[model samples]
Target: MRIRGLTVTFGEKRVLDGFSLDLPDQGVTALSGPSGCGKTTLLRVLAGLQRPEAGRVEGLKPEEAVLLFQENRLFPWRTVEQHLTDVAALSGGMARRLALVRALALGAQGCRWLLLDEPFTGVDQRRAEGLMEAVRGLRVPVLLCAHESHTLSLADRVVPLEGPPLRRREGEGP
Candidate 1:
């Protein structure tokens, strides 16, 4: 997706200012920054969960993308299989079981463009890698917010955010 002259504010804090980015049509892009740097806010804007005060975004369809928030957001009482069925509407039988397997492997399923926030949370390196592999298997655009360098490295391109005005660099380390 392409964003131009984007601005977002939360109360008195200007999370993003005059930010712009052009994402590739395919492949993963990693967003990295220190805490409270507006990376998550940017993702929300991109996902259409939050609105920007002023900006223009093109080439993204709201219905086709799925966002995985920083928190798991899984229903506390729902089993893993139930969660996938709830979101993707895959009922019992081979389809539901396959979706659950995919989600368990990648930690999410059925999203064309997966927006993952801190995907590695509460998981070991091996499990995280398994999840990452599942994400790779989807062969879709993946946007990730990451604190670890190794996790960021898995992305096709890494964008590092610094301060307000939301400067971005391609293939840079935070």
Candidate 2:
């Protein structure tokens, strides 16, 4: 996907100021950055959940991308077999893992891109790696946000970001 001159400003904080990025046609691409640096905002914009003030995203449709948010948004009452049950019954890490699995399953159905926002936040490193292996096997492309260096390393490409007016780190673009 190609994002050109994206500008999203929330009050006084300009989350994305003329930000642009080119996502590869295949494989996993991870966005690595500090907190409040617009990583989540960028993913939200890509998923069409948050509209940008300016710019356009090419080659991706809202319906074609599935966003797995930073928090596992599983319902507490629903019991979807082994993958999901009562939300209170599972640990934080277990919930996050289950959420990942569910998102992957949904994304595989017809989605073109799997956009994940810190999907491994509560999961351990070992288990996170295992989950990443599963992600790498997907036929569709992926754009995910990751804070851990190890997690970023698992991606085929990593885009390091910075600033309240988020921008790709100098000399770090594909």
Candidate 3:
């Protein structure tokens, strides 16, 4: 999506202020920023959850995107297999792996894009690597927000954010 003059305000606090950005046609692009800098907000915008007061976003629709948050979206009582059959068939050891299996399954469902917010927060290094690889093999594009350097390496590019709400800083590639 192409964002022009995007503004998100909560009461008087500006969450996003006249921000502008462009999501590429394909590939992974990681977004990094300090706390409360609007990285998650940006993902919500892409997911059509929160609307900017003034902005024009081209080439994005809620239906075309999926926002996978860090917290589990699964039911504690329901086996991963019940929600998704493929998760059941992911060889063994799925009991210890959640991020990789879930991500692979979601990406396999087919969508225009996925906005992942630190999808591997609780996962181990080894498991996170496998998840990153699984995410890498996805057919759709991904925009990720992660703090782990190892995990961030999985992205095709990085957009390091700074300032309140966030403005893309220089020195980071496009």
The prediction achieving the highest lDDT against the true structure is 2
Per-residue lDDT of candidate 1, residues 10-44 (tens digit): 77888888887888777888888887788888879
Candidate 1 vs candidate 3, lDDT winner = 3
103: Cα error in model 2, Å: 0.6
| Candidate 3 residue lDDT tens string, 36-118 | 78888878887888988988778877788767765555555666667556343332334335544665576677778878887
* Model 3 C-alpha lDDT versus the unseen true structure: 0.75
Instruction: Give the clashing residue pairs of candidate 2, or none.
Output: none
Error of 1 at 44 (Å): 0.9
Q: TM-score of every model?
A: 0.79, 0.91, 0.83
lDDT score of residue 142 within candidate 1 = 81
Candidate lDDT values, in order: 0.70, 0.87, 0.75
Better of 1 and 2 by lDDT: 2
- lDDT measured at residue 125 in model 3 versus the true structure, 0 to 100: 77
RMSD of 2: 2.2
